[model samples]
Target: MSTQPEHGADKRRSTSAMAPRNLARLCLTYALAGLAGYLATLIGMPLPWMLGPFFFLTAASVLGYISPIVPMGRELGQVAIGLAVGMRFTPAVLLATATLVPHMLVSTLYVIAYTFVAALLIKPLARIDSVSAFFATAAGGVADMASVSKEYGGDPGSVAIVHAMRVALVVAVVPFLVFFLGDHGTAPASTEVGATNYLSLIIALGLAYLVAVALKPTPLPNPWLVGPILTGMVLGVSEILVVQVPSFLIIVAQIMLGTWLGSQFKRSLLVRLPRVTISAMVAASFMIVCAGMGAFVLSYFGQMPYATSFLALAPAAVTEMVLTAKVMNLDAEIVTAFHVMRIAVVSSTVLLVFKLYMRMKGSEIGPGIQ
Candidate 1:
């Protein structure tokens, strides 16, 4: 009896225990990321907090420094970003933004079709399997796509790399292009930042975290990010929320997000499959071109600045795109709405879209994922 109790106790403790070496490695990884962010600031880089850490960490990881990763780093960053973006949604802005939903939906369909063509390229370009190509080219979150890939007999590793490469490329390139092509501060926030209400911000964060936890089991993508945005929108639109997310927190959030994204780069994976990596670069460029074309449509439809439309339709993570919009003084609300709609559509319909694409190819390659 005594032995059985000791074994059970040990098992419970073992599950939660962290080795000291692992903890040290984690600390070291963050230190490197922070140092990179600081250096980026010194050079006056665009979106320096994110881009700096992203490039440095990516290079370090690829150079075999370590298998870099940050636990819950992205989620924490998203919570802050979601809250900050949500506070931008005053009643008039939210209502006015709703009218553009139809155009956004059209763009979503265009993106789905774009990914379909991109996946086809993977076959001839990379000589990879169809199953892997299908998942690799999805515009949904990298983690979400990679996680479900294995269920469909897909190469999760390849999918992860492709998506990460695409995101990293978009986040890196789009801002510079947007800045160089035109002036700055053309599309500032529709609503001004109200007085800092730390109490309301804290309470809203706690509430958003709770709602995010509740939505986790649902099919809602990026619940932590979506939760705070929704909470902020409802509160702000209803005249309850009255504070901006602290600038310091937003900067830290950017650093965390940038570091996490940079950590996703696996040099070993890229080195092992150079052709796939090359294909990823081509696909990313194709997507960027497609986004630029879509930007014209959005700019015309919404009568907004081209830069705002470009970021709105940019093929990147919602948080990253919205943060870019905020940094450039573009219309963050429009960017947020477009990404929210795109992600919602992609997350819900991605599998169905894949099936349709397979049918179009006249190759019933994969059955429905369970």
Candidate 2:
């Protein structure tokens, strides 16, 4: 009888000791996952390697949701992704408007309208909330929309699903669209650009890291609209000023963003996979239809060719869209602009509506947490 009490005491002591160790292990796992994800993207992974972070972090998050291993929320993720997007800006990107401002504006407005249309159409089919539908249907990348959904109190799971479907569908479909539509005489990327100067690459990576760290402290007023893209753009313009920003560094950041986005796919996240899959398909198809409409308007205003503009409207990552534009020798500037505009419009609209709703409800609004 005395031995039984002694054994129970030992068990309690061991459990207490194990808790902190397990937490340390979890943190290490997530850090490694982030690094691995970046490596995978560098080696030509179809998706971003940073996804490794999302995957493991998601697992930790789910565990925390049930018991508290790591907190699961989208705020930090949103800010990171947003800051990366802000880095995409430069004066040249704005210059796309010189001859095509009216057209670009029309195309942008069309895409915004189409997001609502997609929400309306897909709602009946997917059996998800209209806000969820709106997010999924937006003509922005799946990752961006998912982040916005979390910020606006929409269903993150559903947003993740729909956004994934849009990206997968577009990536699958757009290559063929390019093959069929691209001008037959178009040249592939120059061999000089591909030769890979190692010294340049190292310098670029260092700069990317520095810039990413610096931007972390900048008060990003609605980073989802301005962070990553603006940062990229500013740095890009610096290169034109003879500051010599390496191209490889920007690519590294892009890869990081992509990988991080993928990291959301943890085992625990799988629980809701079935519902997410269904919603994604319905939302993607509906959004595609809306993109078609946007393309028509862009064609009318910009007098830009229909194929490239349509591809711009296709729901995918800005990086992919811009890369495709460069490959097909289409106007990459327009593609980037449309992408940035879409995120800005969608995030702004969602936040505005959320604020109004909260105000009307007269409930407490929690400021976003880091």
Candidate 3:
């Protein structure tokens, strides 16, 4: 009986000691992420706050320089990003892009086909199971695809790594390609903020947070992102509020997202999965080429700018592409619409495709190529 009190005291002491250490680690992680973002900005990197921290954190994680705990503030960061995306959806912008729905549908189909082909190639080169390769090659959001991969008997970690690499490659490469290929002098329009704007921004954020929480239990792909986006779109379309997400908040979101993504990489993974990593990079490149070709086709037939078409066709994360479009002064509404359609279609059909593949293969469930 006397031992019980000592045990309780020891547990309490350990907990008290751990709490401050955890807090310090978290603060250190954010500071490093923020520094990386600042450095990227100084060098004129595209989406510096995001890409910078992503690269930095990935390297830091692999080098064993940072703790692996995901920052607690990451979800709030996502909410901020959702709000930013939502503000772009004015009724005029929606109406203007509505005519492109057919085109988006066709483009989405092409993206699916391209993803399958890439998966087939990676299966042979990487010796990954079919389900894993399929999910890894999918052109959906990384977290969404990773989560779905787990449900479909795919290796979620492998899928996540491949998806992260794909998005990183697209984010790093597409902007430079667009800039060199198209006019770069035009600047994106800026919004002026007043006191009323701040109030509206707060309301918009609150609505987004509430909606995201409500949608958490749904079967939606990326409910956090989708919920807030839908809420923001409604607000925008209804003209209930005209608000701008502050630049600082945007940077914070980017840092959080980047850090989260970076923490997904493990040092052991690099050593153990070199073939998977290299093959994923190759597959991603093939997909990018396919997207570029499709973009060229769209440009030729639709008489649209090649840069805009490239952005719409690129299989990068929708948020990343939309942000890039905004920065490059491209038609962000059109780009966002195309990506949303592509993701929706891909998310809905990916499971069906896996089932079909399983049926065709007679349930052996072996490594696809080896």
Candidate 4:
């Protein structure tokens, strides 16, 4: 009996010692990862402002072989921004949607075709699975790609890595293109905050939140945010109110999104990532090709400028793309249209494809393991 008590005491002591050691090791690891991510950002990586942290979390989950469903904080920032824009849709915008729907569909086909080509190219070069390649080439935002990747059986680690690289490159590269390739002469003077109407903004937000909550049961991404904004915009155009999207709010949203996203890098993972850079480049080229085609098609339909179409087609965040349009003095309406359309198209297609794939495989692709 005495010997049994001694054994129990030793076991408890062992657990007590292991707990702090494990916690300390994990903290050190995360700190190193955060440091690496910050350094990568400093050296001119395009790290999508929100997608980066999500990627970091995803990678951590994958490495630990933990459940890959990590909560994304940056997504909240994106939802807020998306909701704000959704609120900007006036009655005129809604009316135009009738015409835009067909156009969006046509453009969607081209986007899908382009995405397929991206997947085909990535398969041979990336050594990643087909589903991962599909999401990687989806021509949507980095976070969107990650979400879709999870929907299918795609590797979360690869999706995170590919998305982080794409955002970094696009952010670093696109600004230069805007400065040089954009119509500097026609760029509008910056929006004046003093001229912004606060009552209208509040009304838009309130209406949007209400609509969003109503749409919560659906699988639409961030329905509470996107749905309400869309409804608010409709109301705005219907003489319910005149809403103004202020520049300061947009900037604050972007910075908050960007800094939080940028913090997901770990030096060790990055060092391992160099091996995957070629695959990422190939994937990026595939995305650019899709964007180029989208630019041409959207231009043909909306008669929107190429820069506006190109930004929309590029798989960057909607808020970031809109902000880019603002900075370049491009058309925000066109930017929003293409971005929203891309999300609708990709979400619907990916979900349908995943369903069919799971049915065929006799198992849930991205669902919890049996």
lDDT of each: 0.76, 0.52, 0.73, 0.57
lDDT per residue, candidate 4, 197-283, as tens digits? 787777666666566667767766546445755764566566566555665565445544454434344445556656555687667
Pairing residues by index, what is the TM-score of model 1? 0.88
> How many residue pairs in model 1 have overlapping backbones?
0
- lDDT, candidate 4, equals 0.57
Identify the runs in model 4 with alpha carbons over 4 angstroms from their true place: 1-80, 83-88, 140-154, 184-203, 206-217, 222-225, 351-370
lDDT of 2 by residue, 224-268 (tens): 323434544555567531122233433444333433333333444
Model 2 stretches with alpha carbons more than 4 Å out: 1-96, 139-154, 184-201, 216-276, 352-370
Candidate 3 vs 4: which has more lDDT? 3
Runs in model 3 deviating more than 4 A are 1-18, 68-72, 141-157, 179-196, 355-370
For 1-370, candidate 1 gives per-residue lDDT tens digits of 0101122333342333245656667667777777887888898778888888888877876787653344456777888888777877866787778888888899888888888888988767878777778888888876677766776777777777788778888988998788786646653343354466788878888877787888899887678888888888887777775567777888888888887667556677788878888898899889889889988988898787898888877886788888888777777888888887888999888888877777777875565543
Q: What is the TM-score of candidate 3?
A: 0.83
Lowest summed lDDT over 10 consecutive residues: which window, candidate 1?
A: 1-10
Per-residue lDDT of model 3, residues 321-370, tens digit only? 76667656677667877887887788788777766665665654433322
Backbone clash total, candidate 4: 7
- Candidate number with greatest TM-score: 1
Which pairs in model 1 have colliding backbones? none
Worst 10 residues of 3 by lDDT: 1-10
Error of 2 at 101 (Å): 3.2
Ranking of predictions according to lDDT = 1, 3, 4, 2
